[model samples]
Target: MLPPELPPLPALTHAESDLVDRFLEVLDLVGRINPARSSDTYGGLRAAQALVGRAAALRDALTLMHERGESSIHATTLARALRVLDGERRAARVTLPPAGES
Candidate 1:
């Protein structure tokens, strides 16, 4: 059972549902990758970091919705998540080498 502070899963629109699905897919991919064997050079760590941030943002949005009793109002959380993702992209570009490179 979810804790009392956590929100229940609210009904999502088609597009919102798709977004959640994609978010989960990215998270799953990040989870399955082996950093030592295959993900060391392709910004995998950064991608995983970004995905984690996204998941956090999604959770925040849901929580806010619960608090506000407005499941549809998620712009603030989405904006924050986008900023985090952009930072992750920039960090990856600066810190990681191109895929297949040493």
Candidate 2:
């Protein structure tokens, strides 16, 4: 049996998965930059900080939507389940209301 605190893990739709994968690739790029390279001009450190910070924000938002009984809004993209609520027409689709505000 699953714990009550664990809101269901909705599988990411193809587009959602693609976006997350792209973000991971960007994160990989951010991680591969050499320490010295990041310190060069053009505010590299600040730019990296922005990227990491924004990614963290996105992660947090997705986590909240999936776990806690809160808004279904993702960082920028709504989940497949939510899109189903908007009457997505397809052969197969996931469907569910958010934790609250039915």
Candidate 3:
């Protein structure tokens, strides 16, 4: 039997797409840099260095959107996009584990 179909992603402008992609890149790097969860100092250091560029790219994406007059964020739609991209699980990695867990 086939698996259930996933919902289509919401329509987004080019800038919105760039923003989401850049944000996810930053989120993944942050997760990698979480010292509480990471064991390798070198790896964490690498991730920390990469984060600077990813953050700048994220800023550039937002700046492009602003320059293009996309002033209002469609939160509901963006949240859906994030969910579809496994952002909830990715974001969880950056947080401290619940008390008594980690």
Per lDDT, the best of the predicted structures is: 3
Candidate 2 residues lying further than 4 Å off, grouped into runs, are 1-22, 25-29, 36-43, 68-102
Worst 10 residues of 1 by lDDT: 87-96
Best by TM-score: 3
CA lDDT, candidate 1, residue 10: 52
Name the lDDT value of residue 31 in candidate 2: 44
Whole-model lDDT, candidate 1? 0.52
lDDT of each: 0.52, 0.47, 0.93
TM-score of each: 0.34, 0.31, 0.92
Which stretch of 10 consecutive residues in model 2 shows the poorest summed lDDT? Answer: 86-95
Q: Give lDDT tens digits, candidate 1, residues 1-101.
A: 86445333455544554455455545454543435334465567666667776777667655655665554646555444434444344334334466786
Q: Over 4 Å off in model 3, which ranges?
A: 1-4
Could you arrange the candidates by TM-score from highest to lowest? 3, 1, 2
* Model 1 lDDT, residue 76, Cα: 57
Can you list the residue pairs that collide in candidate 3? none
Better of 2 and 3 by lDDT: 3
